[model samples]
Every structure is written in structure tokens, then in C-alpha cells.
Target: MKKITVFWGCQIPGRLTFLEKSTRLGLAALGYEINDIPEFGCCPEKSLIKNEDEKLWLLTAARNLALAEREGYPLVVACNGCSSTLKTAYVKLKGNPKLLAEVNEKLWEFGLKLGGSLKVYHLIEFLADEVGAGVIKQRVQKPLRGLKIGVHPGCHQNRPSPAASFEDPLNPRKYDILVQALGATTVEYQSKLMCCGNNLTLAGKLDDGWRMARVKIQELTNLRADALTVTCPACFMQFDQKQALYARQGDILNLPVLTYMELLALALGIEAEELNLKEHRVDPSPVLRKAGIINEPLPFNEEVLKRCLTCGACEYDCPSARTGVMSPQGIIKRFLNGEIEELINSSEIWECVECHTCLEYCPQRFGMEKVFTWLKHQAMVRETYPNSLKSGYEMFVKTGRLAKIDDRQRQKLGLPSLSSQEPRQFVEKLL
Candidate 1:
């Protein structure tokens, strides 16, 4: 049996335990053996990297990869951030012989040499490549049955990829292939390729964060998506669990968000509870219940902590706020407001489209979407009608679409018209 090292980062253990389960089981079901890298610890993450200690970051990553190299197996990471960091460190070292020597010199302390021979892959890439989508397609006991699904791959995964693999970082389809194997249809939304607004949480720009998710959610809802699926835990937090946070201030948009594994597990005949669907802050139970997968709604948790330092790094990178709706100043006002809950529940927070601009900029590693997610949960509890989000909610309910603009809107806006049959499709066409 072939075996690989599982790099379980910090977030997977504390925040996304089921991801570990789904990846472990999903791969096991496919006959690939996996083992935990016991010597491994935190990837030090983006937060620690900011301390300006490039050498430490490089050495640590090299050490982890070397562990896999020593065992003569490839290194596999479940977290998008970790995958990006580990892969980037390897690339940085391999590309620069001098830096490689320095890092390797440090590695000599641990009885390791960094020649960068280890292969690091994100879970999605490994599944589509190693497990073989055809095999997954054949094992679909409970296919998604053409259920509408939206995908948001995190930014870090592909930002550094000069040569694309698995899927385009800007427009990922690896998850879509798995979704299709489960008999689901993927949504073609404007921000479908956008980053989740997680990074913005570190910055003080909550509004910018909200708009990123809002834009994507609004698009997906307009596309009539049944649910949103994401690979990264942070992406999962922004798009799926934060709906309630954005709903409180104004209109509420209801969309069930699930991990790629949870969906795969459901298709593989695993129970919802076992996959931790109930733990999602956005309350996916109603959506799953509506699909007849569950009889009753599961409990929804809204855990709001203290205010983030409000760095506004989220606004710095948000594409929507950069283009429309919430401006930089507005982001600060919401995050700096006296009534934190009211600020979070406000309609301004509902405008995000889930693009990951904020996550890309935040120096603090705060989750910019928390305010919005908390608000969405509050609105759900109060049974309040979401005013800012009505149009999107109605769109999904009406057309099974997630975009307000159709081919006609494209034409009116002077955007190239998509052909009914072949206007031009890229990601899906590639698949």
C-alpha cells in the first residue's frame, strides 16, 4: 500500500476537525494509505511570517518537507495556507541557490539537507490526480444529483503558482470535477473564482470583508446555487458560516455552505453529523433538511469574540470595495463602531462577495468575515427578513442562478455576450 504524510496544520485541529476526517477517510476509501507526520507542528502560518524572520520560515518548511523526503513519500497538506507556504518555501529555496545553502546549512543542525525533493500537494490536487476522478465517479453511491454547488478555492493555494496545476487559482475546477462526479452542477458566478474574505479579518475593514463574501454569495444566489463548497477552512468560514453575520443589519441571504469533504462524504453515504455539518455557524441543517437529507434543523452556534484591531488590510485588497459599494473609510467605520453587534448586523456588512482580497492583505491573521458571519447568525435567530440581501435570495430561489446580470446584462453593460451554447467557457470546458 502506498503511504503519504498528512500535514495537519493548526486550524484543521481546532477549527476544522472534520476536514481532517473527510480527507483521511475519503482517501482511505480510495485505497491510498496516509500517516501523520509526528514531528510536525504549526506551519508558523502568515502571522508568524510577519515577524520578518524569513530564514526561520524557510528552515521550518524545509524541515517538514524533509521529513517526507526522508520517508520517501510525498507530503500532503489539508490546509490551503499551509500548502501555499510549504510549496512557496520549497520554490524559494530551490530557485535561489544561495538562500538554499543558508537554509540547508541550518538544516544540517537537524541532520537534514534541503535539496527540495519532496512533493507537496493540496488535498484537492491529490484527489483529482492520485485518486483518479474516474474512480471517484464510479464510487458515487449518493451523487449530488445535479444539485447546484458553488466553489471558492483559497488565494494562497494558487497565488504563487507560476505554472497552474489541478485548477486555476483564479478559476478553480478541481472541486467542480468532484462535485460533478457526485452528480452536481457547478455555478458560473462572477466571483466564483474569488478568494474568501477571511484574510480581511486581520485588518479592520469588516465592511470590505463583508462585501467580498456578499459579491460572491449574491452572484451564487443569483445563479441559483443550492450550496457553496470550499477547500480551505478559512474560505469555508467566509462564504458558508458567515451568512448570518451579514444578515442582521439588512436583508438575509440563506445558502448552505459545506466543505468539499462533507459533500463527498454525503455522496459516499456518510451521515451529516459525522461530517460535522451541524458545527457550521451558518446553519446548513435547514438547507440539508430542505434537500430531504435531514429531518430537523441542527443547532447553529454564533460565537462572537472581542473586537479585532481593525487593521483595514481587508479593504486594501478587496476587489469589490476597490471597485464599488463599501469604500475604505466605510470599512473602518463599521469595524470601529461602538455597538459592535449592531455594526456587524448592519446592512453595509452584507455587500461582500467572498473574494479573498482582505485575507491577502491582513498582517494580523484576524478573520475579517467574523462580524458578518455573526450578524447573519443573529438575523437567522431573530427570524428577521434580510433587506440588503433580498435581491440575491430571490434570484437563487427564482432562477437557480447566482448572477443578477444575464447575457442581456452583459450586452447592456458592453461586456462580451456569452453564447447560449458556446459563448465562451473556460474552467468547466477544461474539465
Candidate 2:
């Protein structure tokens, strides 16, 4: 079996043991031999310590890396912040002899020197690149279908390109690809790439941190996303804890925030209790139901569904309905009247562009867009979709992007090179 030193970092073991538990179980299920190092301290946390003392930060991170070197095992970090700090330190010490010597001089007190040779990997990068999403999908005993997950790839995961150049900083898709591989739809929210605001809390600006988390939770809630998935424990805490804190004030966000590993463990047939999901601030029962992990059906407000059927408010806001043959209200009405077969047989159900305009404009807050989505899923399972729809789906399933950027046109306009397309190979197999 493949082996690597698993760095649980500080937060996971201290406050987020659920994340650590799920990560260990998930990785082991994926056939990795996890070598635990109890000697490792905090990745010393870059934002807090590095800004305060650069020298101390470098020496501390270098010590951790040197230990991994002595163990003769590459490091696999579970926390994005930890990975960011370690990777940045590795690049700096390895690239600069004088800096490495200075750090090594300090480390020699503990009989350790900065080896500057061991490689480090974030857990997400390891799974996306090494374990491969294709193999992961094959191992899924319970696919998280019928659930919409909002992915929050924390800022430190793939930023500071010189240190963490494994993924595109501006448009990272590895998290989204992994979510899709679990058979859940990735919901696109406005604040998908925004900071989780844990830094603000750490900086003693508690309200500001809550405000940042609130904005994202509100957006994801509005989009009707079932859960918010994250790779970092800090981001997970920001969303999970803050959401619960706000709820105590009567402002209920109610979105279940889960670490990617926790979600993966669930899909790998690990029980919810084993993953310590109940310890989460927000209850994940609704999300579990939607994912079919629980044996209960998700409750739908019949009055709201009925109100949506009668009100054509969504149709006016739908771009596809405005340009195409069918309206959003028409699809809902047909489904309500038990014309499911006709709706499935027709191409009107597939005409939705999934722009989510109806969701935004619906006064009842529950729109027919979700109804259309369910219909589309049924159509897909029945293989009754239109040829054009099939061709587009096939193309997207084959290529991560619907269409490639015209490099020639970009060059003529003197634009910078296009972002990385590394997601194509893994995403194709995922779909």
C-alpha cells in the first residue's frame, strides 16, 4: 500500500477531531497506509504566526518538515492552512541556502536540520491527483445523488502560486470535481471563492467574521444548496460554528457544513456516527436524507410547492423560459397534474439552462427550477433526452469545459495565458 506521513495539523486534533477521524478512515479506505507523527505541532498556522514573526514562523515550519524528512516519508497535510504554511516554508528554505542555513542553525538546538528535500501535499491535491477521482467513484458504495453541495476551497489551498502551484488559484476545480464524483451536484454561489472569515475571528474581530460567514451561508441557502463542503478545518469551523452561533440569535442559516473527507467517508459506506457528524453545530439530517444515507424522506412544504405551481412568477424571471418553448410554471403545473410521463417524454423539461433565475425571483422561495431539475434527472435515467442535450452532456462529461478558450484570439488581444485546464482528465472520468 502507498504510505505517507499524515499531518493532522493543530486544529483538527484539538477542535475538529471529526475531520481527522473522517480523513483517516476515508484515506485508509482508499488504500493509503497512514503513518501518524505525534511529534508534529501546529503547521504553526501561517496567518497568525508568520505575520507576527517571519523568522519564528520559518524555523517552526522548517522543524516540522525536517521531522518528516527524518521519517523518510512525504507529508500529506489535511488542513489547507497547514499545507500552505508548510509548502511556502519548503519552497523558501529549499530555494534559499542562506535561509535554510539560518533556520537549520536554530533547529540544531533540537538536533534537527532543515533537510529541504521532503515533498508535501494537501489532502485534496493528493486525492484529486494521486488517488484519482475516477478510482474514488468506483469505490463509492453510496453515491450522494439528489444533493446539491456548495464547495468552499479555502483561500490558502492553492494561492501564492510560487508555493502552491498545483492548482489554478483563480479558478480551482478540484474540489468541485471531487464533489461531482460523489454524485452530488455542485451549486455555483456568488461567494464560492470568498474567504471563510476565520482570520477575522482569529484577529479578534468576531462580528466581522460572523458577517463574512453569514453572506456565504445566505447565498448558499438562497441557492437551495443542501450543504457547504470544505477542505480546511478553519473554513469548516467558520461555517459550522458561526452558522450555529447566528442561529442562537434567531437568524437560522441551517446549512450543513462538512469537510470533504467527511462527505467522502459517508459515500464510502462509513456511518454518520463513526464520522462524528452529530458533533457538528448544524444538524446534517436533512442533507443525509437528500443523499439517501438516512432511510427517511426529505420533507417538502406542500403549500409552498402548490403556491409555486399556481404562481407563474418564476416563468417571468426564467431566461430559458423566455427564450425557449416552455415556461418554468408550465413544467411545474404539468408535474403537479400527474403528467409526469408527458413531461419526461418531451424536450421541454431539458430546456432549462439551470441559470437559477427562477430560484432568485420566486416569492415563495421555493421555485419550479428544482422541479425541472428532478425531471431532467429522471429524463437522463430514462435516456429520453434530446440529441442536442445528449451531445452537450457528452461534451461536458468528456471535457471539463464546454468550449476551450481561443488561445489565438487571446494572443492577438495581448491577454495573459488562459488558466490551467488540469481538471479535464479527472473531471471527464468523474462525470
Candidate 3:
């Protein structure tokens, strides 16, 4: 068994202890020697601190690496952000002598030196590559059969490609492969490679961050995905917290977002209570019931849905509203004014492009998009769509693209080939 120092970065230990718990349970089950050093501080999280002070970022990260080096064990990080920071610091200090000297001078006062022996590994990659998916599959006391999981690798896990060499940066397969070994099917969805938008929130673009999460959630919902699995704490917070926040404002996603470790623990036959499923904002009961992991269903809280009607910010900024065919605000007003039948019958509901702009802009953080989405579903059930809409749907189903891309024309223009195949495949799976 290989011994490694587990760096349970600030987020995990401070807030997401469930992730920490699951990670320990899964890793222990795998028979790895895990060591926890109290001296290890924050990976210092690369985004905010690094931007503010580069030297401080390097110093702090170097200190963490020094602690792991002193232990003579490679650092295994559960958070993608922490892995990126620590790994980047390791690569930088080893390659740049001057910078390493500067950092070592700072560490010398504390009886620590940034050493060349320290290596950082994201826990997901460690499990996939080092532990081997075969060993994991063999250890599965309970396979997650008949479950459809959407994997969110988060941005930092496989980027700054030279530093994080474990997985492909663009099209990662390790997370998907790891989950599949547990007997669950990974669902393909749109923007599967995009960031979870948590960083945007830190940058004060709260709506933009939620928009990133909302789009993915909407696509997953369309795919009828059972649950979403993420390896990063920031991504988990974005999906889990924002999804719950949206649920409170009547935009109910109801998709249980699980950390990869949590999912792994479940496959290892760990009970829901042990994994702290209840701590999650969105209820995991739907996923639990689907997996036959739980018998009793959790009750839905209707009070959370009562708040979205008052906030019309989503409608005010809606592009569809500018067309005068009934805005999100107007639809909500009509519903509140006892015109539910008229609102459902109106073709304006279908005009929503599902851009999720409304969801993003709402002050309450949940918008009229859910209301319009429900109406659109009702229209589909009633077969009340216009001829143009029917034609567009038929075209997409037939050709797998909203509009054809002429590969010959691109070739003639000396341009690179358009990457439409992957998206087309996603569309096929989604449809």
C-alpha cells in the first residue's frame, strides 16, 4: 500500500466535512495508508490570492508542499483548486532556481524548505491512475447499477496542462471511466467541459456563476439524469448550493449533486446517513430511491416555491420579453392574477429560448424561467406548438444540427475543421 499525505484543504475541513468523510471511507476501503498532518494549511486557493500577491501565493503553497515533503509522502488533494495550486508551485519551484531560492529563504525561518520530492495528486486521478479502476471495481460491495451520473470534473483538475499531467485537459475520460467501473452510466450533456462558474461568484459576478450552473442543471434535467457527481469542492458548492437556492425560488432542479467520493462511498455500500446526504441543499432522496438505496421518500417543501412570484428582474432583462409576446414578468403576473388557463394556452411560453438569462438575472437568484419551462412542457403535452417550431424540432432530430455546417466550404477557405461531431453526438444522446 502506498502512503500519501491527504491535503484536506480549507473548504473540505471547514465546511464540506461530508466530502472529507467519504474520501476517508473510500480510500481506507482501498487499503491505502493515509496520513493527516495538522501543519498543512490552505492550498491557499490559486484564484484570488495569487492574483493579489504572487510571492505570497508561492510562499504559502511552498509551505504546504514543504510539510508534505517533510512527511516523505506525495500529497493527495481532494479539491481540484488545491491540486492545481500545489502542483503548479511544485513544478515552478523545481524548474525555476531563482524563485525556488527566494521561497526557500522565506521557509528557512520556519525550519522548512520547498523540496523537489513533493508531488501533488488530485484524489480522483489518484484513484483512477494509481489505485487502478480494476481494484476499485473489485472492492465494490454495492455496484451503482441502473444509475445515470453526470460527471463535473471542474475546471482546475485538468488544466494548466503541463502541470496537471494525469488526465486530458479538454476531453477527460478518467472520471467517466472511474464511475463506469462502479456500474453506473455517465450521461453526456452540453457544456460538459465548461467551468462550474464558481470562480465568477468570487469575482463578484454572482449571477454569471449561477448561470453557468443553471445551464448544466437544465441540460442534465432534460437528459433525465439521476444525479451529478463532482470532484471539486467549489463545483460542488456551485451545483449543490445554487441548485438548492434556485429550488427555494420555485426553480426546482431536484438533482442531487454528489461529490465523487460520496458516490464512491455509496458504491462501497456506505449508508446515506454516513455520507451526510441530508446536509446537501437539494434532496438526494430522488437519486436514493432510483438506486433503491432508500425505502422512505423525503417530503417536498412547498414553502420554498412561494417566493419567485414577486421578483420580476428575470422578465425585465429577458430578450424574449422585448418581442412583446408576453414577458416572463407578464406570465407570472397573469398566473398570479388568476389567468392560469390563458397563460398556459398562450404561444408566448414557447418563445423562451431557455437561455436561462432569467434565472441568472433574478435578484432572488431564482427566476421566471421555471414558470415558463412548466408552461412550455404543458404546450408540448397539448401539441400547441406553431408550424415553424415543429419544423425546427424535426430538422434538429433529422440532421442533429440546428443549421448545417459545410465542411467543404471550410476546407476551401483554408480554415480548420469545425468540431461539430462531438456536439452532434451529445445532441443524439440528449434527444
Candidate 4:
């Protein structure tokens, strides 16, 4: 077995210790022994560099890395900020002989060197590479059959230059594929690709966070998603535990935010208490209950649904509208004019790609995708819809496929066909 130093850092223990524990459990189950390095302090995140105290952050991160170096193992960080800082510092100090001198001068106080002896890694990187999703799939003992989940791969983990090479920044399926191995269905929604409101949270801007989250949740809810799964701790806090505050302010949303480890824990047949499911500030029990994964409804408070402001913010930013798929603005206007009931059967509504761009740009916290979702649900339930959707709908119903382009057409356009004919069980499971 390979030796690896587990750097819990500080934030994971304070707020997301469950994730830390679950990760350890997940990796251990995969036959890896992770040695804990607890003496290391905070990574100081971006502040050390932003404050022009690169030595401080470097020393702090290096101290952690040095422990791993001494232990003859690479350091694995669970926090995004810590992971970014450590990896960046390692590369930076290793490249510049001058910066290396400066950082080493500080490290000399603790008898350490600022050389390239330590390697930094994020847990997800290892999971995607060494441990591999195949191993995870094989380890799944409890298949989450009735769940429809949305994955939020947080900006730091796979955005603005990914932390890992294997993680495709723009389109990631590591988390989703792992979820599938556990017997759950992953739903692609408008906000599935959006940022997790981390910037808004850091700026002490609650409204921005609320608006961003509200739009995201509305889209996921519209898809009838059981939960919004995440890999970042800050993202887990922002989306999972902050809903009640947003709801109290009148923009009602019911979406459970779960950590990737929690999902893995459930799949590994770990009990709820061992996974720390109770500590989530947001009550996930309702969504779980609705998915039939649990018995009782979560203690989520219900609020009176407010009428959409019809501001067309969602329309302005929606890619579908830009691509001439549907008039998101027009739908809002028509709905306000008491024509939504009539518009449900129209192909215009089904044309939405379910991207939450409109929600991001909307001045009001109105989730327009929810309207689209409601329309889709009504169509499926009532069996009333347009002929234009017949192609996609039949593909979904008969072949468990969605939006498959002709193979010849795709080759003609120099594009690879990404669509596949899925199992009927998977499609029906989602519905």
C-alpha cells in the first residue's frame, strides 16, 4: 500500500469534519492507509498571498507538506482553499530559486527546506485517478434507487484551472458516475454547471448568495432533483444550510445539499449517524423522504409561493433563448397574462435546455426554470404535449435516450456524439 499524509487542515474539522471522516472511510475501504498529520495549521487560504505575506502561507503550507515529506508520503488536502494554496505554493517555490531562498529562510527556523520534496494533491484527484470510479462502483452495497441528484462540482475543484488533470473542468461526471454506481439517477439541470455562490458568501453579501442559490435550487427542484450533491465544504455550507434564511426572506426553495463523501458513505452501507447526516443545517429528510430513501419528511418549512416578477431576467441570460429555443421572457409575460396553462403543451416550453443562466442574471430571485419544470411535469402526467417534442420524448420513453443526434450528422459537423441510449430502468427511475 502506498503511504499518504491526510491533511485535514482546519476548516474541514471545524465545519466539514463529516466529509473528512467519510473520505477517510471511503479511501480505507479501497485498501489505502491514510496517515493523519494533525500538527499542521491552517493553509491561510488566499489571505496569506493577498496580504503580501507569501512567506506566512508558504511556511504554513510547507509545514504541513514537510510533515508528509518526513513521513515519505504526498500530502492530500480536503479543503479547496488549502488544496489550491498548497499545490500553487509547491510549484511556485520549486520554480523560483530566489523565492525558494526567501521561503527557505523562514523554513530554516523550523529546520525545514522550501524545496520540491513534497507533492500536493486534492482528494477528488486521487479518487478520479488512483482509487478510480470503477472501484467505487464495485464497492456500492446500497444502491440509491429512488433518488434524482444534481451535482455541483464547486468552482475551485474543477474551475479556473482544474486541480486535477483527470477532472474535466467544463463537463465533469466523476461525482455523477459515482452516484450512478450506487444506484441513483443524476439529473442535469440549468444550475448544474453554475458556480456555488462561494464568492457571494465570502463578500458577506447574503442577498447575492440567496439569489444565486435560489435560482440554483429552483432549477434543481424543477427537475424534481432529490438533492444537490457537492464536493466543496464551502459549497456544502452555502447550499445545504442556508436555505432557511433564504426561505424566510420569501424566496422559498426546498433543496438538500449533500457532500460527495456523504453520498459515498450511504453507498458504502454506512449508517446515517456515522455519516453525520443530522448536522446539516438544512433538513434533507423531506427530499430523501420524497425520493423514498427515508421514511419521514425533513423538517423543511413550507412558504406560500410568490408570483414570478416577470422581469425577463431569466430570459435575458438563458442560452435557450439565445439559441432561439424558447422565449423565457415571453413565457413569463404570457404566464402573468394568465396563458401559462395554455402554453404548457407548446414546444416552446420544452425547448429550454434547463441552464440557469436566466436565474443568475435575474434582478428578482424568480426561478423561471421551475416554471419550465412544472410545465414538463404537467405534460408528462397529463400526456399532453407538442409534436416537436415527440422525437426527444419518444427517445426518452421508448429508448431511455435524450437528444441523440444522428451519428452521420454529428460526424459531418465535426462533433462527437455524446448522447447514448440509456436503460429504460434509468429513465423510468428518473421520471
TM-score versus the correct structure, for each prediction: 0.65, 0.70, 0.68, 0.64
Residue pairs that clash (backbone atoms under 3 angstroms), model 3 = none
lDDT of 2 by residue, 46-119 (tens): 77899899888888889899989888877898988888889988998889998888888889999998776787
Local distance difference test, candidate 4: 0.69
Q: What clash pairs does model 2 have?
A: none
Q: Which prediction has more favorable TM-score, 2 or 3?
A: 2
Report every candidate's CA lDDT. Answer: 0.68, 0.83, 0.79, 0.69
lDDT of 4 by residue, 1-431 (tens): 66678777666788777778788777776677887766678776775353677667777776666666777777777766667777766666677888778777877788876557776677777676667778888887655655778888766665445333346777877767777766678898766777767668778887787678777888888776778887777777778667867667675676788877777777777766677777776777765544334433212212212244424455457888776767776776675565644675467777777777655665555467767776676554334566566567777776676655578888898999655655766776676
Clashes of each: 64, 0, 0, 6
Give the local distance difference test score of model 1. 0.68
Model 3 misplaced regions, further than 4 Å: 296-431
Model 4 lowest lDDT segment of ten: 297-306
Q: Which of candidates 1 and 2 is the stronger one according to TM-score?
A: 2
Which ranges of candidate 2 are over 4 A from the true structure?
297-431
Q: After superposition, which runs of candidate 1 have C-alpha atoms over 4 Å from their true positions?
A: 47-51, 163-167, 248-251, 286-292, 295-431
Which lDDT tens digits does candidate 1 get at residues 193-278?
67677778657677787788888888877676778887787777777556777777674888778877777777776777777666
**RMSD to truth, every model:** 20.9, 14.6, 17.5, 18.2
User: Candidate 1 or 3, higher lDDT?
Assistant: 3
Error of 2 at 31 (Å): 0.5
